[model samples]
Target chain A: MRTAFYISDGTALTSEAFGHAMLSLFPMKFKHRTLPFIDSAEKATRCCQQINAAASEDGEKPLIFHTFVNTEIKHIINQSQGISYDFLDHYVEPMEAELGIKAQPKTNRTHGIHQDYNFRIDAVNYTLDNDDGVSTKEYGQADIILIGASRTGKTPTCLYLALQYGIKAANYPITEDDLDNLQLSYDLKMHRHKLFGLTIDVERLQSIRQERRANSRYASLEQCQLEINQIEHLFRQEAIPFLNSTHASVEELAAKIMDEAKLERHRY
Target chain B: MRTAFYISDGTALTSEAFGHAMLSLFPMKFKHRTLPFIDSAEKATRCCQQINAAASEDGEKPLIFHTFVNTEIKHIINQSQGISYDFLDHYVEPMEAELGIKAQPKTNRTHGIHQDYNFRIDAVNYTLDNDDGVSTKEYGQADIILIGASRTGKTPTCLYLALQYGIKAANYPITEDDLDNLQLSYDLKMHRHKLFGLTIDVERLQSIRQERRANSRYASLEQCQLEINQIEHLFRQEAIPFLNSTHASVEELAAKIMDEAKLERHRY
Candidate 1:
């Protein structure tokens, strides 16, 4: 198999995202074996061993993508008798020339700007009324409120917006209360302009929710449909902009939101 | 004051990280303001308004580092009057090129054979029993295990390793159970060679934990001290390789881990 690895000496999600993106851009001639992490000599040995075994069995070598960071493992693998792989660092050097301008710094006015933005996103995640004595202000302070039913990729999307962009993105479940009321929270109403809605295909939502709380009322497709319809109606009535979260990756959706909202700019 | 907006029409943290990295590389030469998460036309207007108001007060011009993905926002910003800004898309060209090479598909298997040797390093922040959920029977599966206490910079380190290199990294936290037992899980013990520990300054750990847990028992300095001591002792007893997860940023840590671990080389 033409295996491709998206390995890392650390977390591989981002790399995987990039890798997937790259793969999507290109013709898939190879069987991709994207590994997100390879952290030790032993692990390297095991990978080597597996490759060797695979080679012996198939009477041909399988293509491996070595996305890892440990040098010792590199050395062993480099000196290894067999197996195919590629390292990403060697390929990144050419791109350095594009960053012609040097990065600049922050001043007094920029003091703890990160802290402020982070707090804003956290503020939005907190449920004020029913919070378990934690903090409510953090959730309320969110610059953007994401409303959706459960398993609509709301948390991940909000987190992506918050962690990657440093935007204060808060998400609240369009709970039964909100649905029954046929309206959003008073707090949300006050910040209606900052509200964005995410809707997904019923099947996709059900599958995602299944991974978490399974066969529950919350994960039910019918409930999802009802809530989605109610939420969509509410969004229409309130004139809040919304998107079909289905088929849209977090990156695409975040880009769409930012483009549409023109959220305030900050000196990152 | 010269105000600059780091408008992220996308996720802001990545922009912020890039911004911080850039700022560190090149210190600020002008009065600057960093406004993050400007995701819409109106928000952009509001940001401009704020900047304009500030500029009127200081009689200075503004510079903006707009990190965006929405072509529409770019169009609007391009149309806006008298805003000085640098678009990140113009800068990321080189980085993208390098990523392309690393991610390119290989047609030749002879050379690609030994390329899967690179190992990944994971910087675990909490007490995880195993490296993700990947089983040990899959010995060839893990790249590395980063065992450490909270706020040990595990997440960023892992991310850096993966982003900078193509390594598959999995992290597991060394929880109280692991520490008290003075042993890792049966699965990990079997794959001990893949285990790497990340330690940080107790004070630093306390500070990081404080941000997440607040004034809880876990965030206490004394608790931190005791847990660190226990974990360290356990590491020593097990003869596990380890790193101090303090002072160094993500880039530095990943580089060091790669060098130390001798991660395998990818032939391709």
Candidate 2:
């Protein structure tokens, strides 16, 4: 087993993204360590020690994926025993040439707080307030409304939309009570344009609900199938756009919804 | 403003991360567009047209940051008028050589559903259930607990932890009522090692709370100052680790806490 390090003078998020994408190309696993905010010479020296230690312990040269604005610190890490891959180093020069602007490298620029930061916080609060059909009053303010039966991956998807894209996503759970009538509420009908639906395989939904509420009717296979059928039918009859959550992660679902809904992402 | 596109066969998240980091180095604005799940040849052709249109409209070659696994799709995208920067292309060969494994290029592997995927979803559910001092009974299950004053950036940070790291983070808000005593509750005492304090500048806290509750006492500077003072005192007396969230984004705060707390990010 080898080691992979994502080190940076800032949040190291971009480093992680780059390294993770790169590593996913191979079919092997390595010990992962992220050293973030390593802005000082002293910290960089200590990071070198960790890299060397990992090398000695594993008897394999560690892989260092780093993005550093501070040249002195980057110089120190580049001296370590690990094989260095500065993902930004290759592109920045070409990009600067292409854009006719020199890259003014700076720490924290990648994930720094900007003017749109407040919009993300506001979106988070809005999503939380409107989660799980808690209130339909703020549907007018939502960028998109995700409606689905319980355990169909609504709440997490809403939160991801808020956190990642600054989208005001409010979710309504189609409950057992709604299984009978299978009709949209007055409020949802009023905001039909904003409505997007989610459906899951009966087994997956049952397994998820089982973990939450074991052996209950809510977790029963029959209940799960009936609910998905009704809700998806409702989506079709009402002409609501929807997706299957059975095969998607929150990131996938959020991005798909953003693309399909053609919503303006408030944050870059 | 020139347009910058983050396109991919899958989520396009890595493309966004790489492109954003690269673009942030230049002091300019870009009209950002993200095209995710462009997995088909037809979608690739449409994407090429969009890129060509952007190039013509901007009167400059648009910046395209993309990661595609399908070669046919990637080839079509590469032929677009926009200057393509497939960040993954430059490194995959080198990485594969070093690892002695042929790169298994596959779509969705970067942001795919996997075994650890459930951990993230579960973390999201746990964080949501235990948010904003809502419940403490489940604190025993939390990997880390964030204690903070109102509007000091507790909820969003916790969600980021759960979503990004698969760390089950629970946040408890330290209210004005607790300002007088400013002592750790019994439950907190039992898990003092898990507790991480967050403090914000009085002015920022007041302004943030003001947005939530217009003119309430909670939104007053004096009240915020009082709570922060008592909370800092408690943090010092109890030997609890703390960080100031005043100038930090949720990503920064979460990364800092993960570092200081020596937290193992359950996601790679």
Q: Pick the candidate with the highest lDDT.
A: 2
Give the alpha carbon lDDT tens digit for every residue of A223-262 in model 2: 8888888888999999999999988989999999999999
DockQ for every prediction shown: 0.11, 0.86
lDDT of 1 by residue, A1-268 (tens): 3344444444333334333333432343444443334567887777677656655655555444343445687676555434433323432332233334433322212222343443432432332222221223555566677777765656545544553455667676777877887977776777777788888888877776775678988788887788788888988998989988776545456656765677653334
| Model 1 lDDT at residue B2 | 46
lDDT tens string, model 2, B52-143? Answer: 99998999899999988888998999999988898978898888878888998767888878788999999999998999888889989999
Poorly placed runs, candidate 1 (over 4 Å): A1-138, A185-194, A210-221, A258-267, B1-25, B29-146, B153-178, B185-196, B209-222, B248-268
The CAPRI-style docking tier of model 1 reads incorrect
Candidate 2 Cα outliers beyond 4 Å, as residue runs = none
**Tens-digit lDDT string for candidate 1 (B1-268):** 3454455543343333333333333444445444544667787777667666766765754444454455566666555433533423332344235234333322211111122322211111111113333344553555666667755656545543443354555666667776777777887787788777788889888887898799999999999998899888878988988888665444445556765676642212
Query: Given the true complex, what DockQ would model 1 score?
Result: 0.11
Please compute the TM-score of chain B alone for each predicted structure, in the order given: 0.53, 0.97
Best by DockQ: 2
- Sort candidate 2 into its docking category: high
